[model samples]
Target chain A: MWPPGPRGQPRRVAPTIMNDTLLTVENLKTYFFTERGVFKSVDDVSFTVPRGKTVGIVGESGSGKSVTALSILRLVSAPGKIVGGRVMVSCRGVLQYAPTGTVDLLTLEESEMRRFRGGKIAMIFQEPMTSLNPVFTIGDQIEEAVALHQKELNEAQRWEQVLEVLRLVRIPDPERAARSYPHELSGGMRQRAMIAIALGCRPEILIADEPTTALDVTVQAQVLELLRELRERLGMSLILITHDLGVVAEQADEVIVMYAGKIVEQGTVRQIFSHPRHPYTRALLEALPTFHTTGRLRTIPGSVPSLAALPRGCSFQERCDRVQQRCREEDPELMVMGEGQVARCFFPEL
Target chain B: MGVYLFKRLLLIIPTFLGITLITFLIIQMAPGSPVSLKIQQMGGEGIRTETVSKAVIEQTKKLYGLDQPIHVQYLQWIKRLATFNFGDSYKDHRPVLTKIREALPVTLLLNFISIFLIYLISIPLGIFSALKSRTLLDQAVTVILFILYSLPSFWVAMILIIYLGGGEYLNLFPVAGISSQGVGELTRWGQFGNVLWHLVLPIIVLTYGGFAFLARLSRAQLLEVIRQDYIRTARAKGLSESAVILKHALRNSLIPLITLSGTLLPAMIGGSVVVEQIFSIPGMGKLGFEAVLSRDYPTVMAIAAIEALLTLVGILVSDLMYVWVDPRISFEGM
Candidate 1:
């Protein structure tokens, strides 16, 4: 067990579903040391994902959604470091620290972390154009991933696995596509290839960071469905990071809504979507253009607060329509609302 | 691709002709004349009055083919140039083509060996510096390479000669010429060994400058490529840092480096003139230098033509390599 201190103090609550918990991130803070100063991109935040369930971290750009995912993999490189947090991941009944898991991804002797990265956890990036190597054929790249993770597999088996995953991601003519370079394929195909690569190793957790954002809307729908199908078939947990609330509705069982590097609302998908508590969540819901409404979608009046020079009280106070005098003086802690729902706000809508 | 190559090949004609024409005019316009130099050398200190007469000048002009019209001579040179016949050297009385052919192999061999060594040493060093960028190793390499690059080739060559050429210390390598003795008597391996040994000083001087430039360029290119998204993807896919660097970043980085390497060919050839002079190696550079000093118009023009051709060939090879390295580049479009 890690030493208990102000920095590593555990939130006094019963650990939830230990057996099913695949990844647990507690009060994670990631800071970037820039020329100006240290910018806390991912301030204190926490979330958990059960095995075989998809958890969506929804936020607009710069909301630290992607940073949270990156921090989990310990992929946040220089200028950025996880100053404080415990990322506990349960692997085969053993609870290991996730960020610096039992292998200490942050401090993991490079060799050990190298083993954990592609083998235990893998990530799919946002832009497929920039994500895949243009010079190498898709087949060679996927085979390399397989070979890196499953070193015991013979060359023939590795090729077979690559073809199989390529098929799993529903890439048409897997063999032909495998030989093609990144530019030869359309954007959707490239994204599918990326997913195929991430799924190649059957990782315990797959971090899909806006994997479908670059594709066309129809293609985005299909990619999302493909992800759902893969997750279901493989029985793997997924952390889907996106700004699209619609994607969360379709793909996620639970949702964590982040605003300005802090989680504003955390609950089951139905609870957060139907009866959102935080004022920022309500603003987000209002901002979503709906077929049921004919008028212009309501816009949040002001921008999210800057992390460096945040206001004394709520970070979203300047933009909140329901802000009170007390709200300007004191920041509210995350408090439990109804069953399985938590909102960080002093006042919650019934 | 074929069409691109055809167009490039066609462009070479005007380019070569332009170079040949300019070289001819430049040689003619220069203050010294090969004819006068020849006459002066042949006449000697106590020349007879009859030998120094206008009749002797006319005879010298006729003997050297300078009596022909300038345009007609240019045409003749072009006609021979098309067939790779570079006329005769005024200084040695040997055919210019034969002289160039004899000297070219030595220059080519030296440049080739120096380039090979540069790559062998620089690439790993470049990659290492890039990987450990901002570290002491990177700082040390950057400083050393910068110093080496700034140093003059002749100065470096002189230092090598002084230290290795038995300057009160040790005689580790041969001081001059490409071969130890006559070329025919040396066995095949012995000949190769002799050439290599003779090349040590020149290669060191050339490699010091060349390796520094290439390493710095490669390191910069690699730093950019490493920051690219594909490299990040490779790492995310669980590839070891070494795998990400070698398989992903390095190849993409080499694309720009290939273009740089192509441009460096002419530079290497240019640098070899000083190198050849310092080592006393009988290469094209030395021949060209001698031709310039002695006012050998034909030899100078021929060397100029060869240099132009080499530059074109280097660019052509680089364009071709682009297709090989990146499939997306359509040569026909260019």
Candidate 2:
């Protein structure tokens, strides 16, 4: 996956290898086993990330967007378990399992999963200030990642690889920055160092859980631009989880609107924005105060349901403006509507 | 660092003076005066008690320079202390420096062994309990260590002497002093072994409390540190659980312990008074305790001065260590 150059030369993707599904999550149900029964954080959600494409997961707080990303890496802590799911991850150049051609990450052994992580798939988190180690130098942290995954490369080669990743993330003065501690760098540079570490293994898929949530608006724009450019240069799939619709609008090739731990609507970015099917999606779109929108910001009617005490039928029935009697009678199942678009609603807005 | 240390050393003088002043005042105001105490000890030893009249007491006081005004006596003592002259013992007239020199090493040995055991055993136990939290092993260790921590050192010492020292049922290790009477005749290794053997009961009593406290503290601290964002980042970087915990979380978690290192050395040299007394180890604690009991002003003031110096030096050293353990804590501009 290394782009051949003198380390810092900008590389361009050919655009012909973006057709295959890089990763597929099937009927994923990540539930929390608390003192009070099961709390279904992510109940029967499904999605896919195509190669070299971006999948945006947009939801309010506690919408299981972050949980979805954690489940992919099997990083969910105790009291919260991935009860049922198939996270089928395939390496870019090789099929790890010969017969099935893809590995179920959930069922993979811990050693195997470790090899898969940061090598085939990697994750970046929010809170760059807290996410980087305060003790070690930036170069040391990035070299740790490369040392763990790139076993074939010698120490000198790994050092070269670390320098390459640092340059690829556009960190100026790589040698000086590498020697500096995390606190010595500014917020933006710390985030860039984190990205350099994630890319140390040159993963094919990058799962960024609200990567820009902690940055200023201008810095957010720069980080988003970096992600977009890196995705092109590295030809990697990106799954971006965020609450800002503007972020999803700018970066997402496909958008997934989640409500109460379930996907309410999912489709191509343009189709979902133009023809929103679920009322939750419609309300979310209405809540945003766009340039052309008039009057005060139109807020949704009610708050999101808690996972512990969710509504019996449609989770959004209390908040849906066009809710009917049928919506209160039975739970809505995700039904396919348009080209690869799905909506979970008894009465979709469309 | 060198400059900071020099400044700290200069500050020790005022602190020592403050400590000795308070010790002198308390001794002067204490119930027993040195004249009456020395007179009583002489009478018990069949000396001419009836001839120890007021005139004799005044002569002895003048000889010892105790008949001077309180301020004048204090100034003389301070000047002597500046030249490492701790004066003589009120009880035996032996040099206070000689007595402290003998007792200091035993206390240092006791404290050193206890501190070594505390760190060597508790750190791993803390890391283990944290890693295995909510499991049966974690729960059992927590319950047992808490029980040890809650027990008073004096009571524990008594119980150990009773059971392990052959109080009633059986005699195992010798319970009195540092070694047996024939220790000087033994080989060097045998002498060392005898000293350590005699140290077991007192050291055990001293260290269990420290072990319990430090282990619990490190466990809670490590648990909190492992939850930090960087630890998660380490895990997400595909490091194994042990690698993530040992390499990344361990050093950061131990930062709090570095702050405690300042007190550790002093604590080791200041062996617990009750434990030392029960075991009769003749350590620094017992030396100070007996000196206070007999109103030995010079010995008491000398011990107080040394302790004050140690405390100041410990604080300065710990602050310097904080910078080493945490890169974010540099002593640059500040």
Candidate 3:
């Protein structure tokens, strides 16, 4: 907005997000400093959540999906550091505490960050069974969330909000469910209660980090269904992080495919599923079981490279079918392939 | 909950009887009885005339109800216990109940105050050390507490008496007993302060070991609790670090501490024995010790019976507290 770069010089300027963007994460790098070695958990990952749209980030375990969400909230524990990047959250129409502009969350003080967490952007974890405090009633916990962010509400009104959230999540008998402890509810009901808690503050952006992973298969479907409906009804932007490609295909408008802590492909869900540019993305899609597949299911030839000792050049070079001498010498930058699609490969499938 | 408590209370009866019976039999089987000891004392004084000693021993046995069958004696003892009457102490012909009454308040006072101080200091230290876990300060606290725990209570009491109780070093507190002589002349508040002043050293000796053990226990418990997924969720829910720790984590950690409170009853009587003996405080620990040494059946049995009963009640109270602290534990089934 201020200085123009030298003519024809490639400057690393912040990406432009249109008016509908709710959040923008740019060049986010989260590294874990361990005794053995530094683990580049989320290395130079960037994406955006368009307002009221679901963006699914899919990857295997240790692909930094959860760390990305945690980093967005500045909740990464010690030994892990958000080494570089900007998490610019649009505070417009979010909450009163944040100024009405795009604020870089990484620069905010921890006390100021609290207002953003559970107030503007809330998160729900995978383990619903353990995520809720065992000693507290589901209602009391929800009320705590509401009370912390909604300080304008009195105690009675806060409690009413608790019941309201419980009912919103479709828990039977809101009053009784509020009084019931986490153990008293079934796994599905507990997940629902967790969703209710996350929704208590009416957050503009909801991060569901494998929210259905620990649930039963049937309950998983139900919880996912509830999440889809809740997103539409509340018109909240959701950053759904999961390993399930099918879930992303069914629920997401955009998809970001991560490999070895880096995003290898980013596109519309249909584009990424039908025409994946990166080899890792294609391999993951092939691994998914379909009705027409016969005999043994297809799998990628090798496991993800250990983050502590990632090979030079390309992380996927050892596993890529089209590996070459050039691929061994240089890691490819994320290059635009087709309309609204990008891939981190020198040789795109297209 | 009420039905569960009533059933637990009812179960205490048989348990009390079993404990008392074992203690009574064990004490009775020991080498000497009150009659034999009386005879031995007389003989030791060079007053042993055979016919006179024999007549006196027989009279003593019959008067003390020792001539009855053992089972008959136990039945009589149990019968008296039912009416809240503990027969006379054999060592001194005073009523056992009266002896207990005289000793009970001092022991209870010392123990309750120490217990209160132990929890008050330990709980906060535990929370602090756990919050600052793995830091230099936490490690220092751990090392100091381990040292405190390793030092024997009696040894600590002796050291305190020497250094701070008018021994070789500076005299700061009363060395023996719970009160100054002629303490009644002081005003009421002054009397209380005087007693407290006398108690300072003994209480320090009594309190150090307890707070050491409990602080480590609570620190370990809280360290475990803070790592739980719910604590992470609490932090994610925009709670301050203190709210996440004190509100979300402390209650769960307190479950183990509540479970520990069940053991305090026996510790109240047994733990005080050396402390009371060294300080020369007339508490139940000394009373129980002297009763055992002299084979005073009535006094020993009374103390055993009370200890057993209180232990059962302590366990019950802890179980109820467990339920109160954690909603998951319900005693409805048993």
| Candidate No. with top TM-score | 3
Model 1 TM-score relative to the real fold? 0.92
Model 1 agreement with the true structure over B271-317: per-residue lDDT tens digits: 79988888899998899999999998789989998888888888888
Question: What local lDDT score does residue A136 receive in model 1, on the 0 to 100 scale?
Answer: 94
lDDT of 3 by residue, B1-334 (tens): 7888888889999999999889888888898998887777777889764645567777988998988888898999899999999989998889999999999999988988888898999999999999899999999999998888889988888888888878689899989998989999999999999989988888888888777788988999998988788888888888998899889999899888877777785677778898889989998999999998888889999999999888888888888888888899998777
Tens-place lDDT digits, model 2, residues A207-279: 9999999988888899899999999999999999999998998899999998888998999999788898988
In candidate 1, how many Å is residue A20 off?
1.9
Alpha-carbon shift of residue B77 in model 1 (angstroms):
0.5
Give Cα distance to truth, residue A92, candidate 2, Å: 4.0
Candidate 2 docking classification: medium
Please tell me what DockQ candidate 1 reaches: 0.72
Please give, for residues B213-248, the per-residue lDDT of candidate 2 as tens digits.
Answer: 888888998999989999888988989999999999
Preferred candidate (DockQ higher): 1 or 2 = 2
Q: Every model's DockQ, to 2 decimals?
A: 0.72, 0.80, 0.75
Q: Model 2, which residues run further than 4 Å from truth? A: A1-19, A94-100, A293-295, B1-7, B45-51, B166-168
Order of models, best lDDT first = 3, 2, 1
- Residue-by-residue lDDT tens digits, candidate 1, A279-310: 88887888898889787788878776677777
Residue B106 displacement (Å), model 1: 1.0
CA error at residue A289 for candidate 3, angstroms = 1.9
